[model samples]
Target: MIRIKRAYEEVKESDGFRILIDRLWPRGVSKEKLKIDLWLKEIAPSSELRKSFGHDPNRWEEFQSKYRDELKEKSELLIQIKKLEEKLGNISLIYSAKDEKHDNAVVLLELLNN
Candidate 1:
């Protein structure tokens, strides 16, 4: 199973393989605090796409579309995530966005599940 978690959330054993999917680290979060197993920055949306979306909920639909398009070129990274999930049983995708519902992690979860 794949799960999405906020970078600010407390780490738990049940989180399994924790992967940070953001291009940049979260503000005020330290490496020790986050405790991520992998930082898959390559799977993150491009800087241009990220800045254009700007975490604006109004742009969420468009963001998902554009991000999905970006993901097509990252099949190797996606396969890595799938392999981890197979080995780990549970894989947690971590992100640093304030808006949980509209963040890149949410879109990634959707893509991974489908």
Candidate 2:
């Protein structure tokens, strides 16, 4: 199973394989505090896209679409992540956005699910 979670949240054992999918390291969060098993920056949206989206809920659909397109170009990373998930059993995709419901991780989780 794949799950999306905020990087600010407390770490739990149930969060089996923790992957950080943001292009940049989260602000106010240290590398050690995040406890991520994998920092898959390559699979994240480009800096331009992320900056333009700016976490605005109004632009969520557009962001998802653009991000989806970006994902299509990262097939190797996607396949690697999928294989790792299969081996890990339970996986948690962690992000640092304040808007947890409409972040890159949410969109990526949707793509992975389908």
Candidate 3:
């Protein structure tokens, strides 16, 4: 199974193969503190799309749609994520977004699970 978690949260033993799915590093979080298994920047949404949404709740639907399209085109990255998922008991996708409801990791988790 896949899980979405905030970058600031402490890594638990149950969070197997923790991966950071953000294009940019989360603010104020040092690499050492994150306890990440991988940083999949290539799997993140393009900067253009990220800036366009700007975390607007009104754009959430469109953001998710567009982001899925991006993911569709990134089959290699998806395959990599899938490979990790197959190897690990649990896959934790970490993101830096302040709003848990609107982050890219949520969309990624949905897409990955589907």
Best-matching candidate per TM-score: 1
lDDT of each: 0.93, 0.90, 0.90
What CA root-mean-square deviation does each model show from the true structure?
A: 0.6, 0.9, 0.9
The residue pairs found clashing in candidate 1 are none
Question: Across residues 82-107, which tens digit of lDDT does each residue of candidate 1 receive?
Answer: 98888879999999999989988998
State the TM-score for model 2: 0.95
lDDT of 2 by residue, 80-105 (tens): 87898899888999888998788899
Q: Model 3: residues >4 Å from true position, as ranges?
A: none
Which pairs in model 3 have colliding backbones?
A: none
**Tens-place lDDT digits, model 3, residues 19-102:** 899999989988889998899999999999999999999999999999999988898988888888888769899999989999
TM-score of each: 0.97, 0.95, 0.95
Candidate with the larger lDDT of 1 and 3 = 1
Q: Report the Cα lDDT for residue 108, model 1.
A: 87
State model 3's lDDT.
Answer: 0.90
